[model samples]
Target: MARMLGCSSSYLHKKMKSIQISARKRFTPISDANLEEHVRRLHNQFPRSGSEMMRAYLHAEGIVVQRRRVRETLNRIDPAAAAQRWSQTVARRMYHVPFPNSLWHIDGHMRLIRWGFVTHAGIDGNTRLITYINCSTNNKALTVLSYLFGPPVGTGYPPESDRTTEGRILLWLF
Candidate 1:
């Protein structure tokens, strides 16, 4: 094309560079003061909200914007509020234990079902054996402690529970 126009290749390249338009030089579509303040308020209300959530918020507020536009506007509002991208440089190590009973994992099932009672259980991290299991009307610290190392249980004396008993058990067992 430049040859057809009878211009030198270097001169044509220089002119093209001088006339080239860039997105950065384009005017922003959203420059409203209320939009910025609204973005700030949304971030404060939902600190963990991302672009998708903000888009929903804007839609609910009768404002519609593309996700990219929402993100750009948000970044303009608060750099800290924007989603940060991070990559894991160091790979995670697989779990390893030399012997059984070396580690135990305690987990609580708040409810088996919507109407079910709470249950707590522990397992040997290495052996996969159930170390302890207990069901309580309410999942509480004292109930969990009694299940682990509380006083012996019987009809006369109900199982006595622990305070920070779970953490101590984990520390020693693991």
Candidate 2:
């Protein structure tokens, strides 16, 4: 049979098993009217809730419902609300750099400043390479300048432009 069907024997066996299993299973259809009433009640209580939240609320109320059904019901009942919720999602911005050494991103991370350590790092935007990185006791102008200048000064190749956060020290140095 597998040779005639041009498929592996294991694949044919798996397909036959799945068909038999499905044939033995009985499916009970859910009434849309009853489910829609429950969904409407929940939606009235929480107008801002999405499909996943509606499913959770239904589960809490001892009503088991699928997420897709909840979404379809919600969309039919309130298209405007669904559209508003969809629009609330944030869009990602694309980052583009022409060439390596054209632009360098520099930043000072103060996450460890409470423990008396500050981190400064730089990366070539185009190649995504770590040009320089250092941790120091203070994020002073000199320390930041040294971090920015160390790699270029050593290699005798500086970036065309340096991008950094709007810090007073960085602004003053520029």
Candidate 3:
């Protein structure tokens, strides 16, 4: 090999040693058949590394080459850009139930009506049931009681005469 390169054996060996590479090392620039292949693999693996890192890897493996030369070699062999791309996809599944009353979500919303606070209540869509609703004049004990018990079955909306006994009882209970 030294004679082929037009140098004495000792001089070639000395040169190799000065570069920290053994003359018998398997990797080389244009020879040994697999050098380009190895560099190609490295280029694919470290797509984002600058030329310096590739040079360092080769240097650490005892291959003798300048950092600039290594970068040029890599560019000539692998024409792809240094930047690499990646992505992720996510999917959400819908939930369905077979029957009504299987689930019910209740909530309260307050609105200002003619007299005072009115609470609006409702069930979630999954239940498929109309929400029970009512408007109240006041949130005081008496007003809430009347809304719930409904004017004692049929006292005709509580005449002034009938207002005292039953209404007073319901208000006291609350």
Candidate 4:
């Protein structure tokens, strides 16, 4: 303890600060070539992060650094501006559309049967509702589109906007 050592607490703290400053001053600034290599490796490993994130990642690897320092280093080493350009591409890839019907998706299924007809179905990409389904050998796009908008065999078509009210006809068909 400071009292046992016959020294004030402030004196101990001051000595600690001096030692820390001296140690820090001894650490050489990362070389331009080394910084570039490290940044390149970090970018390749984590392409989505900006300079700030990369700096934090470096610190986690026990390298002492600041965000602004990392940004400057990155700009100098990769003067061609490769990471920034590639980041825009990655940004575009990260976004996912939230709704169905925003995009209609249709796929066919093969069944074990004499005819093995195509099972065509249309889905609203946003709502994930089965807009229509048809098991036919024809599998014509026009035919399926027509049936979807056409009047039901007996009952009327389900509401276009209402997602909760299941179509009685579809339940029966399945």
User: Which candidate has the highest TM-score of all?
Assistant: 2
Give lDDT tens digits, candidate 3, residues 92-164: 6786645543433333344575547576332324545543445655445455444534423332221211133
3-108 per-residue lDDT for model 4 (tens digits): 9989998887788797784334533378767877888898778866667788778877777665677787767656556465555663345634465444445555
User: Candidate 2 lDDT, tens digit per residue, 81-163?
Assistant: 99999999889899899887777777889999999999988778788888888999997878877766667554333435554
Total clashes for model 2: 0
Q: Flag clash pairs in model 1.
A: 145-162, 146-161
TM-score comparison, 2 vs 3, better candidate: 2
- For each of the candidates, the C-alpha root-mean-square deviation to the true structure, in angstroms, is 21.3, 14.3, 29.0, 19.8
lDDT score of model 4?
Answer: 0.61
Q: Lowest summed lDDT over 10 consecutive residues: which window, candidate 1?
A: 154-163
Measured against the true structure, the TM-scores of the candidates, in listed sequence, are 0.35, 0.47, 0.27, 0.35
TM-score of candidate 2 against the unseen true structure: 0.47
Worst 10 residues of 4 by lDDT: 160-169
Sorted on lDDT, highest at the top, how do the candidates line up? 2, 1, 4, 3
lDDT of 2 at 6: 100
- Tell me how far the alpha carbon of residue 141 in candidate 4 is from the true structure, in angstroms, after superposition: 71
